[model samples]
Target: MFVMGHNQLPPHLKKFRRLVYISPVITILSLSLLVWTYSSDMTFQFITRYYHATSDPQTPVQFTLPLHRGPGQMGPEEQKLSLMAVNGTKTVLVAAYQEHRTGQKEVRIIAVVLRSETVAYRCLLRCQEQLRISEGVSTTHSDHFGFAYGTADIMCPLPLGCETASHVTVISAASDSNDTQIQEFLEVKNQKVQSDSFPYNFVVCLSTMFDFTNVLQLVQSLEMLQLLGVNRVVIYKTSNSPETQRILDYYIYKGFVEVIPWSLSKFVNVSRGWLPEHGPGDLHYLGQIPALNDCLYRYMYQSRYVALQDMDELILPQSVNSWLELVPLLEMKYGEDKCYMFENNVFPNTVSLPPPTSQTLPPPSCCPGWENVSGVNILAHLYQEPIITETHYTNFKIIVNPRAVFSTSVHGLLSSLIDCSWVDRNIARMYHTRASRQTELTEDELIYDGRLLSYSTKLIPNVNAVFRESGLLPEGSIQ
Candidate 1:
């Protein structure tokens, strides 16, 4: 096998093979060296620039952090914000004695913070005089969605005629303070008893309503409100059925109801209950707390008194004919600035209606085909259930002077600058008509409360008229 082979190849051929291997290695090393040199030079330049920037006093240095981590963060655009003016002047007019005092008005600013450092507010009041005020922001509460409810108070002094000032420019404070432009303009109107007063004396502020399909009950409720002397009713609507919308439009045209478009579903996942433990809404009950607060401010100066209640509930006076009569009597007994609380009385909707006797009045119907509607028949539910002692039976609702109440909750006002009085249940009570919370309550447990019977005659015709006008019923449906 030992014969002349490639091992004994010519010297020229062997030299070519060695050169091929060595050439590639040399190329790789040269490229690597060039890259290292370039990187080193860039690093040196960056260090030198940074050093000079820090060392020189004239050179401006800028630092940045994540917006959420930063001191003053600009929050999401969808965050709800509002401001309202309260008449700071107090005038006491007694029959025999009179006292008058004039003071600077106060501005209440509310900001719903989703994600921002709304730490302070800069308010500019431009009227007879240009006044600027700065106030620190404070969070009253927060919901499961991490929406921080914040408020700020600003004192505003205006010249005599400037009482009708419409707007105040407001801006959130920033870390890089360079006099940020006004982000929002808050409405400011004199709520005092000037030459012209608000047309409506009482307004019912309903909490946030979501996916409301109760058309029949809604109409009935509206009719009851009219009978109760409610001049206006404001509902914060998140969503509703087509039927409900049509009914609302009818009331809106009649100037009896105002619907505030609530578009919270577009931004966050809305939950049905107060806590997300049950479901997936961030703010409690479709941002109900905020809506209630907003309603208070929205009608603060427009209505003399505001009743915070649900659509299923009605605060009825046992002796008086209407709230118009009840409010005056209440004020005389409890004073003007006091918040009147009414005892809650539950009337279960599951209970069967009383048998139609000669004295019994026939319950009004919504329409022929609408007998099996989605909502409960409020008229059929007149059986008052015995109050459960362990539960918060004594839970109450409030009718407040919007100017005097500072903050509000579901049951009542959290704090009021004025006094609060609990009206006796025998005098006036809240008729809450809804599904029974308890699983069992016999006929013996239910008692007859005929307070609602008085409003039936008027309520039936009003509901029929509203349905007819809205085209929900025939044109001659009232007859």
Candidate 2:
């Protein structure tokens, strides 16, 4: 009866039955279209929530809230600030800011990408118009030391030259449609939005410290840096021992060490050495150059000078007591707008000065309980490898006016208008304490340098105090 009803039904009833059958299919199609529409609007909605309405011909930023991304659409801005790959390309974006240098007049994203292009990218600015300008998206790659994974400045020039942007998002335009995928906007930094005096005089950058367990030396180094007039120490550390973490946390509480997360190996196949022969990886020195460059720009306007050095070394003033006394002399001798290169005078661990006979004599090198700490004591090693005539003035580390330098490298400037000069070793030299580079040299052949001993009177107690603060050494350890 039910099967026969459709053919035997009255004319009016038959039409109504057919309408009911087709309506459910129509409803399903409508819901699918609604979901697609909402998905496309997520980025636009995420943006419009923060930026206020503006119709100015200049079309600068109207306003900006705390820079955050929409949920479930993409991954969270991870707790670790590692390199972010741009939409599945080799191009990994580290940061972005308005370009005031080189007069390029664009927004430059500091990134890790192939030296040559594999894909096209563009700027998706959070402007009044919600602008998408893909025409001027060019690539400026800094192939520092001919390393395989060079740092690229993915350039996005503004059409109306708006430098007042509070933030901007970058996207890959190589897709079938430019609007398919989007990356979160990094709040524009180094903006120079307002002119003011720098907060610090000297800032040091120690990059790519991996698996560090040098606790005693790290404490001694920071104490020495403080004595030498460094206002800030930026450490881009990959990982460290649990003991070392206590020291870093203490220093951070003391407002000295800034530990930037550096997990480049997690993102790229980072090479262990600087040369090409050290391959089976993508970047050099476990991504050292990018970390250095990031530090430079990060502190470009915050500090008057930035010194790039390793954790195990310090650039000490030979004649003067501290860098406050030394830098003025350097400026007077070399003139301003100069990249001051100090010769790396290696203080070999293999050669040590004779121990003091008295607690107060031969310099105050006695510090109790630090002996139990799991790291080298930088003070004990005083003798240095004799400077080689062939390599004289060749092996160097730099302290430069961050604004004067255009591109920075491991040893020195890759490109800069600033001239390079060697400070006389008597004036200042890098006290590099590490495994001996000249393994052939005997004890007598090395020079006896006691410059570090000069700081021992202060360094001894300072080391003990840090141990106390970090809970690294037990009580009754401080004298």
lDDT values, one for every candidate = 0.62, 0.73
lDDT of 2 at 376: 81
Clashing pairs in 1: 270-281, 271-281
Among the numbered candidates, top TM-score falls to: 2
Residue-level lDDT tens digits of model 2 in 206-325: 968788898888889999999998999998777777777767766765568887878777777887777768666778788888788888878888888899999888998998999889
**Which digits, one per residue and each the tens of the lDDT, describe model 1 over residues 2-105?**
22344775798678757687774566578666656666557656665787677755332221212132212222221233322221211100001000123444
Please report, as a residue range, the 10-residue window in candidate 2 with the lowest summed lDDT. Answer: 70-79
Q: Report the alpha-carbon TM-score of model 2 versus the true structure.
A: 0.78
Candidate 2: the clashing residue pairs are none
